[model samples]
Target: MDCVDLTTVLAGITLRNPVVTCSGTYGFGEEYADYCPLEALGGITLKGITPLPRLGNSVPRLAETPAGLLNSVGLENPGLEDFLVSYLPKVRKMPTAVIANISGFSLEDYVQMARALQVDSGLAALEVNISCPNVKHGGMHFGTDPHSAEEVIAAVKAVTNLPTIAKLSPNVTDIVEMARAAQRGGADALSLINTLLGMRIDIEQQRPLLANTFGGLSGPAIRPVAVRMVWQVAEAVDLPIIGMGGITTWQDAVEFLLAGATAISIGTGNFVNPQAPLEIIQGIKGYCEKHGLTSVRNLVGLAHKG
Candidate 1:
């Protein structure tokens, strides 16, 4: 315990630890402040923001599965200006590292937001969410197509001084190809396993459950898939990995770290228990101490040794 070090430096951003909260689930980093103090975790990814404020999809945007939550929130958020003027002030002062998540409809839309958030904004990194699956003609196009992924990432990296992390969608046919594409685009790091595209049926109504008809599926159900993708990407891509999908417990976090994730993010888990990050952090430390490891970073990609 005395010698263990939890510090994690990913994509040039320093974090006290490697347990971060996911965007959308964590809100603007203020909503969960009461339940999970910012100082207790590594960082918080602000909700996905677009160029213009969105009303989002119509009602019935959420559905529940046995072990997952499907949501069609449509990246609803205040426009970039509101986030900069109203949110960035407080976000810059948060106790832990802060990462901004951005989504857009077109290449230019992404470029517009990246130009605004730079080093002066006090952001540790920029998570380009090219994988958002809910909205019609959203950023998923950039996420699924390798060439487009490369182009969008390179475009964002060109304008923003913040380290760029391309959040990849799991809906792709070849995850490794996407990772390679992101690397070519100059992404400093990769956040893999964004929600899988899925939908549900309203048996009672005899129609699709959600008004949007489809949503991003996330939770414990996606953990295995996330880990598989992280392992696959880590094996081929040189970029550090921010593994996330359905990390709810300490063991789930450890699995991701072993699979090659430099850091792990909790999304729907936060909804179930806001204190999850704290518990998982402690659990990782205890695991490291018991194993006689001096740094948590040593856990990343350990499984690959075999």
Candidate 2:
């Protein structure tokens, strides 16, 4: 309802709602424009972009698991230049905020992409994807180590004026340490539980299902892990969090908000149902109205109150 305030402020950038399309799943905002109104959702995170074009991982990049999917699609995208010239213009026209997702093999690579995007006035923020598992260097490596994570965050912050969000990896000894590192490095916000490292084996062929052997696992199966990590990170750091992983329905989104995410991102849910994001947005509004809550922000971290 228009009477209910669903607006959420994430690291100073205000979102009309809490539902955002996760990067790597929602191409650029244009591909899904025909499926749903781009402006209706809170924001859209562009697919990961690097300094140079990426071919991504080898074939057999996707496989299905019990309640999730395994993907090793690397950070496949046109280089930064192509995106700026071809895609950014179209994204600028969208009514919703456009969050650029950047990945790199080195600290320099992250810095380069950040510096290049500084001139784009239409961009809302930069999501530093440090948890990409398919890349050999500078992907999960930086995210798993606090020192490396801090270096990458600090470097990008120095070169760019946009609010920076450090996307953290679940494949770590202590998720809280990683969250603290990002905050210490001056990250404006954080996105937790990128994907759990997993794989499937073709018993008949006696070989790994994915050509990349190991892939990031996502879907309902990982929701519990995602919630736990979000709760832990919330307790450890003061920065706002964009919670994702296995968030398919409004109920799932509510679980994330209760766990402490200021906002939520829909990933594999997009593939299952293109309208999932919009539906979840409406569901949240309905829930707030029925519960007599004036603002959606009141639902955040409610589980931590006890």
- In model 2, the Cα lDDT at residue 102 comes to 96
**What TM-score, computed on C-alpha atoms, does each candidate reach?**
0.99, 0.98
Report lDDT (CA) for all predictions.
Answer: 0.94, 0.92
User: Could you give candidate 2's per-residue lDDT for residues 1-306 as a string of tens digits?
Assistant: 357899999989999999998999999888887787988999999999999998999989999998899999988899999998899888779899889999999999999999987636588999999899887876999999999999999999999999999999999999999999998899999988798999999999999999999999999889999999999999879999999999999999999999999999999988898999999999999989998888999999999997
Taking the tens digit of each residue's C-alpha lDDT, what string does model 1 give over 1-306?
567799998998888999999989998898998898899889889999999999899889999998999999998999999998999999889998899999999999999999999989988999999999988886899999999999999999999899999999999999999999999999999998899989999899999999999999999999999999999999998889999999999999999999999999999999998899999999999999998889999999999997
**Candidate 2 displacement at residue 299 in angstroms:** 0.7
C-alpha-based local distance difference test score of model 1: 0.94
Question: Which lDDT value does model 2 have at 161?
Answer: 92
C-alpha RMSD values across all candidates: 0.7, 1.1
